[model samples]
Target: MTDAAPQGRLRARSLGVAAGALPTGPLNAITDVDGVLVGHATVDDGADLHTGVTAVVPPRLGLPAAVHTGNGYGKLVGSTQVDELGVLESPIVLTATLSVFRAADAVLTYLMRLRPDGLSFNPLVGETNDGFLSDIRRRPITEQHVLDALEGACGGLPAEGCVGAGTGTTALGYKAGIGTSSRRLVADGAPVTVGALVQANFGGVLTVQGTPMPVEEVLPGVRHEEPPGNSCMIVVATDARLDARRLGRLARRAIFAMGRVGASYAHGSGDYAIAFTTAPPQRPPLPDDRLDPVFAAVMDAVEESLLNSLFTATTTTGVHGHTSHAVPYDRLPIRPGTGG
Candidate 1:
């Protein structure tokens, strides 16, 4: 909950950023976006068996917003209205792939039980595949877990790596889980905030900046065999003034950042990005407004967020006796320009 003085170089467990180039907002996290809160429900039991849920709530005081990006590589429940009509009427939820149905149902139940005024609630939920370590087939996630994540949500520094839904995930052949980053942008003479949160379950060879360093290089004897059917669900939130169409374009740019970090969108990997804007609601009859500045902010934030996720993740062990090592802080290649 504290904003440590900005460092000359910010070094995360797995990734590092140049010290003074890009300005990091307070907390340097998705929560930097005002009113955005993140919470995790982690379930870890000794070795291997680990699972949990994460929740991202945008302004608990019922702020109206809209979702624009609608990719199909993975499942994002409650995006239909966001895409069709350009509005998000609920908090966004994230959990394991198999738990989407239960999570969504639980969210609905919470909303109705709390409101009780016949108000409709469309909950946003994103998922990533984590079957390699956990018994995904068993559907271990329950409705209560979803509720716990929701109820426990708060604003502050989010706990990363081996926590929540990221507990059993892997990224680029190494242990990976939830990663988040944020950036501040000034467009059209006003300051705007954009933030990104990711469920790191994608498969790729480890690479930094464009250096192709396969997982085997760092973790000797490891083979590039087919990874578990894994996928990543990235949720981006911003307060910039942008319409749904512009937001969709910004969401697509997140893939570019993913690729920069060495993800290939493999046939078995499900890579998806969902972006929304909490800019004041422009209800019916409101005059159309231009959103070029918001689009630019989205692109900048998505790129930085992806990098943060990779840097924050630490090595982890999961079910089936598989262990993914963390990126070696000493061995990573650092160029003169980019932070080492």
Candidate 2:
């Protein structure tokens, strides 16, 4: 429900830095998709902890969903079920790497409490290592934090950078966190919306629309110590009526978009993307021939979301006095009106 960026921080688009030419939805956020809600529960203790939970809620459970794993280097609870049966019975949750299990359990608890009659449930939970800036060993994410995030889910522009599961995360040698973007297009004369939310914690040679970012030269003395093998979690939502099979294709496009942002997919990176649709089940699936726009939208939204995560994040000092500096505007090679 919270959509406020950190004080004095601006998103990638605000800085005239954009990823694609596709038009964004009204909020330019994942929540722009009708019936999709997002919320965050940040647990910043101000001393050693910088971790939390992010919840993405759909209109209902048992929705058609699919997941694509770019690299299976990290844990993703309930991914097998989603990949096999193509059913998402619970809201998707993202959190710190070490606390994924606790976050998953909390999600089950919340869903069970909401629908006591449901016997079997599959809770999808994803994570990225935040140990660089958080006391990951403490496992600070409690069940209450998950509950708060799930209960507070709302339909609006969600906050970006240094919040929710993105807290303490660093990407591409820069401090990064939660970011979201959406694309609006017309397919077969009917409007369709595709939205994406990303927890960017991986590393690579940063790029903006094919232009490489010279971090060392631009931001002198800023530490880029986070390894190239962290992770990234992407959740995509749409209002298009699509089946699980086609949704899987859409999910893969989301991961492929990572390359657009220069994701390394290193040995230890666990890159995954999950796509789900909110269109009513009674609606017929959109034919595959008309899916080009949808796929393009997914790629653009994912790319933009990654940039927003880094651009909006602020520098932070965490456990063991480790610091992750934010990617400043001056570091980028592209700017407004100059044409990247």
Best by the TM-score measure: 2
Q: Locate the minimum summed-lDDT window of 10 residues in model 2.
A: 1-10
TM-scores, one per candidate: 0.86, 0.95
Residue lDDT tens for model 2, 63-87: 9999999999999999999989988
Off by over 4 Å in 2: 1-6, 336-340
* Winning model by lDDT: 2
- Once all C-alphas are superposed, what RMSD does model 2 give against the true structure? 2.2
Over the stretch 25-143, how does candidate 1's per-residue lDDT look in tens digits?
66667888888888888777756567789988877534444443323566778877677766666678888888887888988987887778965777778788777777666667788
Candidate 1 residue-wise lDDT at 177: 75
The TM-score of predicted model 1 comes to 0.86
Cα-based lDDT at residue 22, candidate 2: 80
Residue 11, model 1, lDDT: 30
How far off is residue 144 in model 1, in Å?
2.0
Model 2 quality (TM-score): 0.95
Relative to the unseen true structure, what is the C-alpha lDDT of residue 106 in candidate 2, on a scale of 0 to 100? 95
